[model samples]
Target: MPILSYLVGKTRKLGLGATRSTTYYEPAHIAREFATLDHLSKGRAAWNIVTSMNDSEGRLFGKDKHLEHDLRYDRADEFVEVALKLWNSWDKDALKLDRESGVLADPGLIRSVQHQGEWFKVEGPLNIPRTPQGRPVLIQAGSSGRGRRFGARWAEAIFTIHPHLVAMRAFRDDVRTQVEQQGRDADSCKVLTAVMPFIGGSEAEARAKRDRHNALARPELGLVTLASQLNVDLSPFALSATLAEVAESPLIHAAAAEKLLMQGPETTLEQLGRIFASSVRVPQLVGTGAQVADQLAELFEQGGCDGFVISPAYLPGSFTEFVESVIPHLQRKGLFRTAYEGSTLREHLGLADLPG
Candidate 1:
């Protein structure tokens, strides 16, 4: 009955530094650790690789100063490259059983991969053998210049938090171009964006709910947040003043929308600032089940997004309602499956068979 595997993201620290940080985990250590998780979870492991931009993260790594943006991703590229070699080190049939004469696994079947790369130099095979599934599914979360390149090259799935359709389409197109340029199949990756639901049975009810949600957000917090994003202070501006009078921005976007704001339909500076303060211009889905389903289908069909990350505004009950009520409607309409058929997440997403 377990369904809808989200990105269990971990910070990918490059270099063979001791796998420290409750905040981050190295791929080499994670590859071995996550294989065990995959074994236990019936092969549902999605590694959402994130190289953080936060300076606090740098301090955790024992660096007094933060890394340059270029260096962060440069290391990410090498980190993933080594991670793949580590994953593939154990072939699909690496574990061969020989039941007679006290034999266990065939030694010939197990081979060590001596991988030496720019950022990592792993000596041999991963501790665990090839899983029932090939490997943990790789999810990439970044929308910056280097981030997109990383996602296009390696991500089987993309976690995006886009503000609107026009921006969403541009993201898809840009990544698709990278796919074409890299000589890889464009369809191999799926882009999932974040959309929060605030169901209402009627339009008036929905609008009222949105107003209530907005009421919970203070304009000062909004102003400060917006200022931080734009790298300026908005304290000088009145809360009632038009945002354009205070600052200029084209749109709003997030990485969990997973990329910084991408160019799309124009946004008023006020509306754009609101997006930063409270996520979801209309990320709040206040509608009936049919209405919500219709919106989702429309987004998938017209917006060109493969699916949504779908965060719950509240905790357990929120996701619980979605899983129990909304998912069945989706299944009945043939938008989602009633059950999982594959062991690993990759197999679940139909990527195990993809040519590398």
Candidate 2:
């Protein structure tokens, strides 16, 4: 938070991720902190609401076990409710800076949140004044059914992972349906899928580069990461065994696991390990600048996604290549912006300003 005050001055938007834990925080704390950050950023703050998938994270929070996936989302639903109430406690014109009359605020313009819910008991108006954007943008990423419902209710933006264009389109359409069902504009929520791009001089070069990256991957790290993400002990399974054998693991997210297995029914643990060790099952876009741009545009135009969250395989190398190569092609095709369209992230994302 101390750093955020200064950070808001440096960047146009900042997203803070949070998880549900018994010992760490409450709705009121999150409400106040993000509200303060929104004020500091002049409406540039975003809250990336997350349910911690790493089972070991519970240990750090003094819990014997992680909360069940569905239950976690249930709690998050209420948590967001309290935060929204606190954020909306004050009107935009609540603050009237009149020096001559020594009047700083209109008392009638602000009110207590007075929220009492299943997951939280937040009392009154936040200590901080209303922010420029009114409140921080809400982001949620949950591919599971319960997770999707929670996101549909409140999330302004959603982060997703789908390895196939067909699946991506389906997910996007489903989310918009969910949004409309909630009495909100379908366009209000933007869906961004994760993409790992391998940009090179040509298609063959990109493939060769990807193969080299795959060769350097460590399967042991993949096992640990998969265990944490799925909340299951995959060590007991043989590396040669098919994913179908372990698909029913109670700890796993059934929907996500099925999707992975469908990619290759005979997919061995080692094969899956190699695929995941390098990338967490996101679709890999491997090609030269124009070819990659064509693929991205196709997906975007087909309603596969609103945008993408590019997860580079290597830091400066991968990002540098994309910016110098792919970005220009996308801009030339009129599929991407060549310059900053707005000052605030909300404006850039085409989100409506918060209600005053």
Candidate 3:
């Protein structure tokens, strides 16, 4: 799969972190920087559209609090719409370099996005022309109902985490339905689950490592985050109590807690505690490279996903290992890229180039 990396920072306000930001990175700068990167990567880069939701971040901008998830997505929707217009404002031939008369661009091919949306009104004729792919691929990480709807309408890739097979399959199906409901081909968008690995030479070692990491997680922060994510009050439940009863709570009901219990009967209240705190029952694929990759393959084969979003405990070097070890195995099985086959992200996604 073609990779999408951030140039500056994240809009951590949505649900993952804070609330929302009033101001920060301008569209023009991000468009230009990302365009140049796409040019360099030869059209294998994507844009992760985000708007910060940190209430503290809002306060940084002299606000009392952050906006809700719905409002944040609304603003980000307008922001990305404007960004797309800025990208398309220049036709591929606008830079018709003619050394004969010293002409560089055709005036007719250049245009502006006189965008006036509910949250953002941007008057822009982007500084940089079009990026290599006509548009930088759009990816969304939100998984809440409203977030899923927003992403299905606009996102080419939906970044999410789900632990239970039942929940993931149901969500994948529902999101696809939403895409169709929005007049888009459900298959046009792809689902990528974040697989945070805790690799070791053996299953026992890997399990130990996973336990260590889980233990390190902050409970208070996790509960706060979980409460916000599930739109439920988590304060009522005691950490020591098994979620056996919190099952009735909308936050935990029909969700992955039950599934996790089914998967690992020995899983303790503390483990369930973490899931509640994190507010996501993403099956943390903790195992050796082979075991992890095999699980990923199983998920892909079952149509639970098109691929994995390997979120390593380590950063750059960790991904390098993933690409070298797991990626090669996946490729040998005809599951991943051996070389660049397309010149653009859309092409990588099997999408047609946009009209002039």
Candidate 4:
């Protein structure tokens, strides 16, 4: 959050997002922190809501065990409810900086939140005034059933990982239906698919760069990560054994296992592990700038996603290359903005203004 706050000072148009776990953090604290960030950034702040995964994260927060998956989402739903109440506590005209009258604010305009929910109880109005954007943009990244439900209710933008176009379109369509069921506009929530691009001057050069990057992946490390994500023990299986062989593991997450099997029942556990470690299963685009742009355009036009979340392979260089190379192609195709269209993040995303 501090890093994002610092970035707010350094940049003018970029949306500064920071993740906060609903399972671990207090609702009031999150409300105050993000409110401050929104104020500092002139409404460019965004909050990526997360219910932290893994038992290890629970241990760090002084819990004996992590809450069950669905239970975590339940808690998160209430947590966000409380945060929204606090954010909306103050009226738009609450603050009145009249020097001559000496009235800093209108006392009656600021109402107490007085929220008491299943996971949290926050009382009274927030100390800070109403934020410029009303609240920071809500972003979520869960793809499971419960996760999708929670996101449909709260998230203005959803970050997802689906390596194939069909899966991406299915997920987006499902979410849009759910959002409409909740009585919200289907277009209100934007779905963004994750992609890691290996851009070069030519397609062959890009493929070679990607292969070199993939060669450096350690299969053992990949196994460990894959085990964690699947919540199953990989130690019992031989590296050469195919995922189809272990599909019957009672401990394995069914959806995750099924997705892995989709790659190929004959694909070795080691190969799957290596793929996970290399890109965490995010789709990899290996091509020149124009070629990469074409892939993204196809996905966008096919109802697969509203946009993309570019997951870079490396740090500064990966992002720098995309900005310098890929962005120009996207701009030429009228798929990306050539310049800032608005100052606030909401405006940038074309989100409707919150009712005052």
Candidate 5:
């Protein structure tokens, strides 16, 4: 969050987002922090809401175990509710800088958010006035059924992961349906799938580069990451055994395990570990600049996603390559913006106004 806040001063038009877990922090703290960020960034701030995944994280929070999935979502729903109330506590016109009368603001314009919910109780007319974008943009990245429903209710943008076009389209369609079910315009929430692009002068070069990167992955590290994400112990499983063999493990998170199994039930633990370690399961897009752009265009045009969350394999280099090579192609094709069209992140995303 500090880094993102710092970047707000260094860059313009880049939305500064920070992930805050609903399972741990106080709703008022999250509200005040993001509200301050929005004001500091001139409304270019976003909060990536998460109901943290790791059980170890629970230990840090003085819990014996992580909250059950659906229960966690329930808490998150209330967390967001409390935050919204706090953010709306002060009206947009609450501040009246009338120098002549020596009045700084109108007390009548501000009201306490007397919220007492299932998970949080906050009395707030937040210390800060109403933010520039009304409230910081809300973002979420939960692919489970409950997670999707929670997101549909609040997320302005959703980050997702799907290995194929079919899966991507299905996820988007399902989320949009749920959004409409929540009485929101389907377009109100943007779905962005994760994609790791390996761009080169040609497709073959890109493929080779990707293969080389994959080869360098340490399977053991991936097994640990996969274990953490699934909330199961992978150490007991033989690396040579196929994921299907352990799909029925009682300790595993069924939904997350099932998603991994989708890669191929026949895929060995070693291979799966390598894949997860390398890309964390985000789909790879390997090709020349134009070819990669073509793939992204296809996904967007085919109802797969509203956009992508580019997961670069390496640091500044990978990001630099995408900006120098792929972005130009997207811009030339009229698929991406060449310049800033709006000052605030909400305007840039073409998001609808917050519901009263």
Candidate 6:
């Protein structure tokens, strides 16, 4: 966060991925860290709300097992409420730094949070001053029903993974509907899809790059990863065994674990293994700059997403290629920014600015 502070005025936003873990650190600590970062960045910090998925994470935190998915999110909802009360503890006009007055701040303007809930018991105003944005932006990336409800109530933005346009559009609409049902403006929460793009000068070049990358992918590593995510070892079963043979795991993200079953009864564990091995879970665009731009524009125009979190299939090289090629095409269509117009992340994302 301190490192990101230096880039505050240079158009950078710090996104801290905070998993729910009251056993390791209290919610108050999470609130203070992000609050401090938000202050230092002058309102450019965001919290990527998450529930740690793996048993490995639980072990590292001194837990015998990870909490059930629904229970974890249950805790998250209360945790966020406490953090918000703390953030809003100080009124907007609480700060009174005046040379003429004998006081540095007005004590009466600040109030105790006094948050007592199922998961946390936080009291009083946070020691740090209020952030420039009043509160750091809340970001969420959970695709499950329970996760979506939590995001609707608290997240200012949501990150999602959808393999098709229809599903993506439906997901966006559903989330917005949920937001309205929660008595918040439907447009207040922005939905961003994670798209892995492999852009090249031409279509053939892109395919070749993807093929090369795939050939080097290790299926065993993918199984290991899937096991960690599902909290069930895939090694015990044969590659040809169907998902129905596996008993439901106690401590897994139920929605994510059920995804393999949704694929169909004929899909072998081997096929699913390859899918994860090659990172084919999220939708991928492998094409020329113009082709990639057209797809992105189509998705954006059709209300499929507010924006896309483009994850390059390969680091630096893929990123450099896209910036030099695809971004220019997007800029030409007026679908992307040609130059940044704001010093803060929220403003860049078309969010309202705080009053001075």
- Candidate 1 accuracy as lDDT: 0.63
Ranking 1 against 5 by TM-score, winner:
5
| lDDT digits (tens) for residues 239-334 of candidate 4 | 898878878667566866786687798999889889988998999998998899899999999999998999999887999999898899889999
Give all TM-scores, in the order shown: 0.78, 0.91, 0.76, 0.95, 0.96, 0.91
Whole-model alpha-carbon lDDT for candidate 4: 0.90
Candidate 5's TM-score reads 0.96
lDDT of each: 0.63, 0.81, 0.66, 0.90, 0.90, 0.78
lDDT of 2 at 167: 93
Candidate 3 C-alpha error for residue 96, in Å: 1.5
User: Tens digits of per-residue lDDT for model 6 on 130-220?
Assistant: 8888887788887778989989998888989888899999999999999999998888899999788877778999889888877777766
| Model 3: CA > 4 A from native | 1-29, 218-221, 224-273, 276-280, 314-321
Encode model 3's per-residue lDDT on 65-166: one tens digit a residue: 667768877766667667778888899889978999899888889996798767667777887767667766777777667788788888888777877566
Q: Which stretches of candidate 2 lie over 4 Å from their true place?
A: 1-6, 12-24, 247-265
Ranking by TM-score: 5, 4, 2, 6, 1, 3
Clashing pairs in 4: none
Candidate 3, lDDT over the whole model: 0.66
Task: Tell me, by TM-score, which candidate is best.
Answer: 5
Candidate 4 segments exceeding 4 Å error:
249-265
Q: The CA-based lDDT of model 6 is what?
A: 0.78
Error of 1 at 233 (Å): 8.2
lDDT of 3 at 180: 97
